[model samples]
Target: MFADVSGPSFIFWPVGCGDTTTVVVSDTEVVQIDINDKLMADEEGNEHIPIVDELVAKLPQRDGKPYLSCFILTHPDLDHCRGFADLLERVMIGEIWHTPRIFREYEDEKNLSDDAIAFRKEAHRRAERCIEEGGDPGAGDRVRIIGYSELFEPGERYEGFPTNQFYTRPGNAITVLDGADVSDRLHAFIHAPFKDGLADDRNETSLAMRLIIGSEGNTLRGLFLGDLSYPTLMQIFEQTHAHENNSMLEWNVLLSPHHCSKKAMYEDGLLQQDVMDEFADSQLSPGYIVASSNEFPHANSAGDNPPHRKARNRYEEIVNDAFLCTGEVSTPEQVQPIIVSITANGIELDIKDYKLSESAEATLTAAIAKARGNSAPPAYKVGFGAE
Candidate 1:
């Protein structure tokens, strides 16, 4: 079962304070959400995995070249879109999904990372082709613009670009990807970048969504909220409930927003219990929350960046022991990507026996001996390398 699963799977790479997820929709179809392929990770002493190579090796091929069915950029942040240009050059991407933030950056003359600039250029090219071809410009030139911005107005850059074919607003559901009908096995409900919040903040304009995958009778739901904060999350919760679309908020797996930043649940130095309550309410039994960040500190200092211990504590309360961190799960000797596979029964982790480092092994041995009145420790299996 570890090596073979009949249904779709989600692979979250350990990129250290970044996000890189691959959704294997099927043997022939796949979608990648964000990327942070650090080239320095390939250095001899670096523990990070060279994700681009790993991804290329696993991706399905078309016309004798690596092919990605769709690539979704949640936002233009460097951590989210880093190495995108390299990926684009090496792989044949069928389509791209993005928000208007990329274009807005150019209008504001904000300095963008090279990858972000490349993405913007590619997105603009596809949008132009979409307009020129009238609709559904076929793979490699197809673009799906999520959320609204003035840039997409009828007489603006997106003029005549067939809004119905290319645009998916917040509160809508998308059943097609790159012109392929995935309604039978996949559905993504748009949930953020609300029309009113498309200001200068890139993080606020992130394309958050609830992705449901599997057969109609049995499915796995994952909520991928980019880097949104408390205010927007509160809005999403209230809006979803008001529209009688609470099902869109349900999830078996949730990628903790903003790499487990406290901002997602904190406002003015206070924990927003309503947000926590909503998450606890929406989670299915045996739920899992994955934080794609570096190993969290025991406690965060004032103004410290994310992977915050306080935020992790709250998420732990929601999922109990099912909360996992990509960084903590990976070892120096082995770069373990968290793999959650869908099976005939449901989703399950592809657990592998992790060899503990010498120091870790010694520490565990001492702990076990102390617990047993200083007796020798017995041999034991470590699941997911958890202590």
Candidate 2:
């Protein structure tokens, strides 16, 4: 029993770094950008988090057919694709959109740890299964990597395919998925890691997307910057400015890039005068800036986990309203996962109001507290094995 919503959009769950962002477009289609750690009960009566499990649980149950329409992997990073293999087996995927980079063989994947290797093997096995099942693996089930240039052709019509195409090239050097009308509404826009040069690894080539739903009349816009660094983000801004005024494209909601790491906004590994001013200005563009990080006041040895006190102060000074972190900002000790729901109208995110389960809530809380003091946060829970 969910409310009937129109205009096609809504983010189902916005868990911090550890969890995945399941974007449900309308009620009919489901698209997951990345699958982090999956929380579940494992064998031996132990609680094992299998990255994809947590994500699937959040999704509404599908009848008999696979409910998942697509799986978009930003890059080949383990944290990004770890859960993809398991997900493919459990659900019926219409298409799999990814970059051109793929593993040469199973040995090449051996470079990863033992656990990492297992995940990679599973992904390959499932991919093979899709082939044996007679589901068009090339463009039908498995699609090759696509860049922005592929979709954007100066004056020519792209012949954009809505569903049948399954996977398509990134448009305008970007990939944007606006939800279709249904029970669960979600919209996403891919932004960063602009292809300036080709590289062997895909992390530098991660496909970042900005997701939001609420503003249709151009009054408000929510934005999410996924695991993107400052140089990459600035590159996008520069390119956009070259085409048109910065005001032409702006967001009302923003997900702090790179978990709001100081490195994201700093130069020479230090926050600089000009960079600070630019970031402050960017914060003003959106009505709200949502930080998706377990790191609170200070998690790293450098000091704070996400933003240092000084930087947070700078954000407050410019934005006037103050920045919002995922966990409780009031106390450094108290920690809990905060799920945010956004729309064109406004944002509704409160830690206390919602409850998933006691244990689930406890795990999130403990992780946040532990990450705040540790120099390095826990490793990301996603993985993408050899192709």
lDDT of 2 at 346: 49
Looking at model 2, report the run of 10 residues with the lowest lDDT sum: 40-49
Q: What lDDT is obtained when candidate 1 is compared to the true structure? A: 0.79
lDDT of 1 by residue, 41-152 (tens): 3212233455666656557798998889999999877788877887898888999999877776454324556777788889989999998999988989999989887766
RMSD of each: 9.7, 7.8
Model 1 residue runs over 4 Å out of place are: 1-6, 39-45, 107-110, 351-387
Error of 2 at 239 (Å): 0.8
lDDT of 2 by residue, 1-387 (tens): 111222233332333343244444545555666554533221212122333444444444557534566676665555455556567666666555554344332356445633345444544443454436444443224442344433323442222322232333332322333222321233444454455524524445666554444334433344544555556656666665686645423555555554556655666666555544554555434355555444355434564445455445544555634466653331233323333444455444434433334444556555545555664634533334322
Candidate 2 versus the native: TM-score? 0.64
What lDDT does the true structure give each of the candidates? 0.79, 0.46
How many backbone clashes are present in model 2? 33
TM-score of 1: 0.87
- Backbone clash pairs for candidate 1 read none
